[model samples]
Target: MEEESQIVFILFAGAFLAALMATFVVAMVILHRQRQVQNKQKMEQLQLEHERTLLNIENEIQQETMSHIGRELHDNIGQLLSLSKLYLGSSKPEKQAEGRELITKVISEVRGLSKTLNLDWVESISIREFAKQQLDRIQATGFCQTELDQEGDPWELEKNQKLVFIRVIQECLNNAIKHASPNHVSIQIIKNESGRKIIIKDDGKGFDTTIPSKGSGMTNLKKRMETIGGEFLIHSSLGNGTEIKLLLPN
Candidate 1:
């Protein structure tokens, strides 16, 4: 009986030690996993901050260029056109007609360029307005019918997001026009519970993209969206249309 009891006690002690070691290993795994998650989050935040800094510098350079061009259009080229207009108005009928035509052409070009002169204009406008401009450009091409529709109330976005969003939309539009050759392109901005959704759909001659055939441009688009806390998705098949979606968290 004494020997049997000693044996039982030995087994019990061994079992308890095994159980303790198992618990410690589990705890260590959980702690390690938590640290990894925290590290990933910190890295993502740092990357976003870096992107914002680069984008700000880019915008500053673009703004400076716009200012210089604006002044040139308003002061130099604008003055030349005004003087020609006056000179033509005072000349004989034949010369006056020619000068009037020349002046009219200059006026039209200047008017068109003036719209592009506002340095801070792109960052100041709402997304809908920016989308309209892109659609209008597509419309001007006469290659496709462009339309934009909104769902839910408009959402406010920061300067960096706005810049990235506009560029991403432009990229999608360019891809649609260049590759898809679509007859119609539509954009929709819907505000949902998860976030804001921007859908770019085209009734173009889509191709097979099932094998992850997107080039660097598309990859860049994905990275940019991820940086802005948004997701990019693309769906397309042979002989069908292409659809691209951008989702931003609320």
Candidate 2:
């Protein structure tokens, strides 16, 4: 009878051990599944965020383009139309001569505006030189003093990428002038194995980034950078200066 009891006890112990091991295996499987689900969720979230950023950027670009068109229409086209009307209505010889001169001036202005709006030459121009021209124009406006620096042999980047960089820099300059009230702005472009680097710094009053304003300009800039597989970093604090850095792969 004792021998029988010992055998039964051993059998029960073995069964218990088996059950314990099975439970452990099941638990590990559950944990692994949960981890996978969490990672998937994180990936989906990131994708959604990226899409939203892109949409915002496209909207901003459209808005900017429309704004430029409107300005040109109002300032150049409207003036020309007005002058043409004046010349047509005038009956006096002296007034007709004045109208003719005015028309000539309007024609010249239209030609200049056309040149400004043309994008055909962008492909032929170097980005560094283009940036320098932009800076010179901005300085001529007397809003702010701007400077540009470059390092390394400038690569021929995609046209859209070049335009995006130009727009982002222009946006930064505009922000510094209107909001930051900066006296000076500096831009630096560099190329390395990692990619193209753009740095825009301004000595102006900066705002808290944690409470970022949903400015169209900023949103568009972030979107453009993301679309190009680039990254942007903004460093600023209230009463301090602002620095924006962008990195784009070669």
Candidate 3:
């Protein structure tokens, strides 16, 4: 009878151990599933945050572009139109005819500028080709003798990056024309160790870049460069020429 009792005890112990092992296995499975779920949630959250950041950056760039375009239209183009109208309303017939012709020319220019302001240009043109065209246009304006140089084989940049580059260059050109009155401008695009580099230099009357109150255009250019994970450095003085170096990472 004691032997039977011992056997019965052993059986019960074995059963208990089996049950415990089963429970451990079940707990491990549950924990693994929960970990996988948590990991997936974290990944999803990261992706969403990345997307939101991109959208915000894009919106900011768009706002800046529109603001600049609006200012150009309202301040420059609008003033020109108004002046032409004033001239048209003059009593002299010769003045009226001259005003009408000037109005026509101004309208044509506005249309051209408006077309450029559209984002379609960014989508349609290759960056290399676009850069070349812009350089030509700047030279045609007779504001400066512009030169473009490319070091490596041309590679297409991301859309937003291209736009940022174009706008920054445009701002620089405009500043050179308006403030520096440069006779010669040189633009160079070269492949650096990590990515791309742009250097724009002009033989013009430079300014004290140490002062923070230079202009909104320069500030805006810096911000645009930062947005694209780039760096901008300006070197200038009172009589010396100005040079701008912009670096963009791969």
Q: Per-residue lDDT for 127-201 in model 3, tens only?
A: 567667767878876767888888986756887677777767777776787788888888888885689888989
True lDDT of residue 51, candidate 1: 78
TM-scores for all predictions: 0.65, 0.65, 0.55
Candidate lDDT values, in order: 0.82, 0.78, 0.79
The alpha-carbon deviation from the true structure for residue 130 of candidate 2, after best TM-score superposition, in angstroms, is 7.3
Model 3, residue 83: C-alpha shift (Å)? 25
lDDT by residue (114-173, candidate 2, tens digit) is: 654545555676778867876786787787888999998876787666666666776777
Off by more than 4 A, model 1: 1-45, 52-119
Q: Give the clash count for model 1.
A: 0
**lDDT per residue (tens digit) for residues 89-198 in model 1:** 77488777877777887778777667666546766679999899889968986988999999999978887777778778877898898888888999999997888999
Better of 2 and 3 by lDDT: 3
Which clashing pairs does model 2 show?
none
Q: What does candidate 1 score on TM?
A: 0.65
